[model samples]
Target: MSQPQQSTVRNRLLKALTPSDFALLQPHLELVATELRQPLIKPNEPVKQLYFPEVGFSSITTQGSGGKVEIGIIGREGLVGVIPLLLGSDRTPHDHFVQGPGEMLAISSQAFCGAVNESASLHKLLLRFTQVQYVQTAQTAFVNASYQIEVRLARWLLMCHDRLDGDELRLTHEFLSMMLGTQRTSATLAVQALEGHRFIKAQRGRVTILDREALENLADDGYGLPEAEYARLIEGA
Candidate 1:
């Protein structure tokens, strides 16, 4: 397999690595295509590898008798499997699956753990990223409990748009309901509301952003904090 270009890698966590730190990981990184809905980590199962996306995003979700709800998203901005690494464990507490189709740089958990153990910079960077993920999860809980479905939907769309390469998002109402932890009807109604406002156009298996600024305005405080935190922490690295 071809080695990843240290400076050109798209994953924010990897890109934030110092030259020496990245070099320790570069030889072990393997570029691989990720399929939509592919499960990368299962709850209570050993996390065998880490995935740093180059194009798409993954959903980190919690499962219970009430079913599953997405708590956070990881894209080129972060890596999957860090939670296990951070806790010094081999298993995850939640399920992680690809939400968008793209490519990722895959590294075996053994290699990643070894690198983290050897590099203080890598250890610190990963810990900071874990904080960003915590912020996202907490914000999502607050949004779900306090905001209207339309506002929540707008926030979700804006998040996906941030990670995606284009304005169009290939998502279905059923999937949106699952992500929002709502019924399909609620998701449809929220989509209709956004469409009526011309903020987004919903179609078969896709939603296209028409006015990102308006959507941002609708999302208000729900969408920007965690993103800003990511920038603040990652850019300073």
Candidate 2:
């Protein structure tokens, strides 16, 4: 298997690692492809591999009384399977899976934990992401509770847009319902609302951004805090 160097990796988390810390992990990191809906962390199952996606993203979801609710999004800007480990657990109650197909640099949890235990700097750097998740989840909860379906949809789209490279998002109404924790009909109506405003143009299974700034305004305070927190903690690292 080919090992990827931290300097050449697009994952912001890997890129943020110091050279010494990177060296500790360089030997173990292998390039791998993650397929859509492929399970990474099954609820209550041990998280054996950690992934730093170079492209695409994954959804960290949990069971809610209503059904599955997406709590966080992990992409090139973040790492997967780190939360349970950072919190001193081998497993988590959340389901983590690929939302889209992409290549990622993956390492075994054993090697990942060993490197973190060996380097205080590495451990500290990775831990900042844990804080970023906390903020993101809290923001998600607040937005879900306080905002209208249109507003909530806008917030969700904005988050997805942040982790992607292009303006078009490959998403369906049912998929969006799960992400927003709303009914499918609600999601469709919201999509129409955004399209009505020319904020986005919704196609069969794709949505293209027409005016990102307007969507941001519609999302308003529902967005930006967690992103700012990520910038302050992870990017600044």
Candidate 3:
């Protein structure tokens, strides 16, 4: 893989870094392809590559009595495999995998740690991003606990829309059900509800956002807080 041009980099965290901070990790950053459903990191396994996604999104999930469910979405906004590293660990219990197909700027765990240790500013920036994750996960918990299936689906869709390049999301009902921690029938019904409201048009394998504002209004407290936190902490920092 080749090194990515700084100006052409699309990852929000990478784009937000100062020249000096970016320079510290530039030599080790390798642009790599990410395929749909590819496992980026596995539970309790040593994390080898840290990916800063440029185009696609990743699902951060865990499994238990409730079954496997996603907790956070890492897209162009953040990096994976660093949360454990930042906390002085080599791995995590959470599962990380590509949900969308695209490219990621990847680095080895060792090199990433070296860079983080070498620059106080870089470390600060990454810690800020970590905080963003905390906010997102917390919001996910709140939304899932407080909202109905349709509202939760709307919130998840809005988050996916924020990460991808277009309004059309290439997610099937089964996949959406897995992410939302609901049954396929429930997810299908939610899709019908959203389509009925003209907020989205759902097909067999794709969903197109037709009225984003309506979805936002419908999902009022289900989303936005964490996104606002991201903008305030990382985008502006």
| Over 4 Å off, model 3 | none
Clash count list over all predictions: 0, 0, 0
Q: Which candidate is the best by TM-score?
A: 1
Find the 10 residues in a row with the least total lDDT in model 3. 1-10
Q: What lDDT would each prediction earn against the true structure?
A: 0.91, 0.89, 0.90
User: What's the candidate order when arranged by decreasing TM-score?
Assistant: 1, 3, 2
State each model's C-alpha RMSD to the native: 1.1, 1.3, 1.2
Q: Please report the candidate that would top lDDT against the real structure.
A: 1
Model 3 lDDT per residue over 1-237, tens place: 567767889998898898888988899999899999999999999999999999898999989786889899999989988799998899999999999889999999989999999999889889988888998999999999999999998899899989888899888888888899998899999999999989999887999999989889989988898888889888882
Q: How many pairs of residues in model 3 come into backbone collision?
A: 0
- lDDT at position 178, candidate 3: 86
Question: Relative to the unseen true structure, what is the C-alpha lDDT of residue 185 in candidate 1, on a scale of 0 to 100?
Answer: 94
**TM-score for model 1?**
0.97
> Cα RMSD (Å) between model 3 and the true structure?
1.2
Residue 91, model 1, lDDT:
95
**Candidate 3 — what's its lDDT?**
0.90
TM-score of each: 0.97, 0.96, 0.97
